[model samples]
Target chain A: MKVIKTVNIFLAIAILILSVNLMKPLSITGSSVADLSDAECYFVNSGVSNDIPIDGCCYEVQKQLECKKTSKDYRCYTSESSERYYVVNANALNYCKVGGYDVKII
Target chain B: MSKLSEDMSKDVKLMIVLVVVVIILIFFNFDSYGVSGEAANTDNIQYEESTNTLYLDSLTLKQKIAQMVITYHKETNKERLQDLFIGGIHMGAKTSKEEFMNSIDNFQDGSIIPMFISVDLEGCANPFENFQEFPALNEINTKEEAFKVGYDEGKLLKEMGFSINFAPVVDLDDKIWKCRSFEGSPEEISEKAKYYIDGLQENGIVATSKHYPGKTLMLWDPHKYVVHAPISRNDLMPFEKSIEGEVSAIMVSHIIADGYANSENKPSVVSEKLIGELRNKFTGLIITDEIRMLGLSDYYSDVDQMYIDLFKAENDVILNFDINLDNLEHMISVVEKAVIEGEIKEERIDDSVERILNAKGVNVIR
Candidate 1:
């Protein structure tokens, strides 16, 4: 009886502690960030694309669309940020891969 | 009686306690479901056939402006809330059931026309402690489940005295992990959202599809940042689907649509460009996402102009829309003052009040 009482009291205490922990404020997790990469640097070096400039000290969005025979599962981060997720596709991914900084899959 | 073994008795005792606990939880669930809202005005909605212009004429310009402004209230102060003469009250999810009833009662008692009580029962963890926790829309997979969830939520909300729900975010950006969105392709969002819209509206609750024209990127939340969406007409398909599905209201976001809202690149809510686009598309209640949102607020140096511009852009309802009562009062005053100066006509205010009255089922015989 004594052992059972002791075990039940411990269990109650544990549950109480857990409820308190669950009520604590949670730190909101935001998305990850990265610096501009080398391929992007190469595109910057090649200043040929009319739509986008190669003066490239600043991080600006350049949208490039590529579609093939089959619409394979492709994901590009949005054509620009702040728009919601782009329709998941790879052409957008490749576009960001070539010229954008911090490209991500939608 | 046979002498039970000591261990067996202990086991029986534990089982009885577990059963009692389960019964208590069940009873608590019933109490949770038992919460109800004010039901005086909603029984009749013969709005298309007639309008109450007599009541409309009776309202002072300040009363009409108050009818246009919807504010978030945490407490149920009958005198103060009635004094504000606000048309709508957004009940926070955190408000307790008893207090929520009190708030609704005060609003009903205070106002001649019952205020449109709204809540965000987003089907995730409900913000209110006494309310039942529903699984997020993302957890729902099939059309049948979505309809059931939407119907039940709408019915419950009506019972709880909420005529409007700011939910089922139709934005294509599912990466933000708000769990408020129905994810997948835009088509999938449209298909699923139709049922949710129907479920709520059909049940007499106004379902509002939000963060309009699509919150395109997954990178940052608009609540914290000046979200920029460079979307084309093709991106607007989700809004089209939700509207077609018969949602009664659409909440526009403050996200700056670079290619869309205009060259000035104002957030869509205040922009004549985007809001004008919405007017072309939807004639229902065009509610703005909390007008106080940073995405829209940071742009206007003169905050009073923000409210003026929202209605100037022809936004029907402003949500949390003002900074404070003083700010709210000033915004109304400026709008009222503008009408008097002929910068804006009183007909515009009448048009807005008409929509609000119709939604609340305040109709005139003639």
Candidate 2:
């Protein structure tokens, strides 16, 4: 009886872990989004900001995603250069991400 | 016997559970677990090889118009582009070198005319970002270093089957990326660009000097849809040197210019006054930056009208990277309709197509 009960518990745990893994693909953190208000944006390289030099925080557009956060009204973008995600009001950055690109990020 | 039977049954149940867990893990390993670009249906297209003797008149209006467009390459839309006979394909970032080479070879084999496989291998804005590394332009201090970097980049690009490199950015000031441009005054930058262009061209790779009217890398406020720059005589020097060196192509920027190479407050790419002036100075291919840029697109209210203006502008090659294949097809049809209505002359299309064919090493007999 103990063996059967142990097997059931193990199986349940495995299934629960799998479900959680399948839910979130992107690692968008809920932390405060970076302040990119004064940051200049480009289609290729991350433009220089008053605070950050070009080398310090250059974000080259890796793949433009189709996800548009309607509440903030900004299109999603992914960069191979930086770990942190930015939500900027720049039309150049916003317009560039208006389509399906890298399959990894939608 | 009863004890042995119970043990065997328990083992079998455990084994079954183990197998189930393994199968579940394997299923999730596939890329289908995440969201990706939609798969396009290219079933109806047929691939045909081009003969050596391709003529100017042999191509139809649609094919000629198609030859003027350079669209982004997607794995699913390979056959669709092959069917359209696009002039060129721009590759985004890719990690595996073998896979990249194979994709280039596959597209080339399917095309009737050899396509210009282009990549942004500029020092800072590298498309081969993940697996490859190259010296940034600003890091080089001498002409010899610039030439060697160009030669090496050209050799690798040629080996990988790339024909056009949109590189050797001659922009004088690069405040945005900081490292995208070579360091120096206009004269020094121009000299390095000349040497770089020579090295790249010598290795059978066509070099392009980009963002033509200068100051494209300057920092700006993001609120304005279109930004204008005052281009000076010094700002024009690098492009002038590039022109003197016979660079195969020059990419026009979206900046609205006022001085020396005046774009007349319009994006340089779509300004006839600007392109016409350039045509007089250089006889090589004049390509535009991506037409989808908001700096250019936001200038007009209607998208179709923007397409008409782009063709009317007389750029030899148009870069349109709209992800949707339908919008690309729609742009083609819209241009075709404009040609039929005489909004854009058929002779103008012939002129651009002839230039495109000549660049592709095709002998155009008119």
* TM-scores, chain B, all models: 0.79, 0.85
Query: For residues B1-366, what per-residue lDDT tens digits would candidate 1 score against the true structure?
Result: 234467757855775565565555545433322212322132222323333333566566666677787775445344555655678877543335666676677678736577888876666434443445466777777777778888988877777688888887777755534465787777887777888778888778988887777763344532334667777554677789887776788888777776544425777888877787778878788888765434565576665566678878788888752213434555566677667777776777788788888788777432
Least accurate 10 contiguous residues by lDDT in model 2 chain A: A25-34
Runs of candidate 2 with Cα error greater than 4 angstroms are A1-95, A99-106, B1-51
TM per prediction: 0.63, 0.73
Predicted candidate 1 versus true structure: per-residue lDDT over A42-83, tens digit per residue? 111112211111111112121211112226543222122212
For each candidate, the alpha-carbon lDDT, in order, equals: 0.59, 0.69
Best by lDDT: 2
Q: What is the Cα-based lDDT of residue B337 in candidate 1?
A: 64
* Weakest lDDT window of 10 consecutive positions for candidate 1 chain A: A25-34
Q: Score the docking of each candidate (DockQ).
A: 0.03, 0.08
Backbone clash total, candidate 2: 1
The TM-score measured for candidate 1 stands at: 0.63
Per-residue lDDT, model 1, residue B238, is: 72
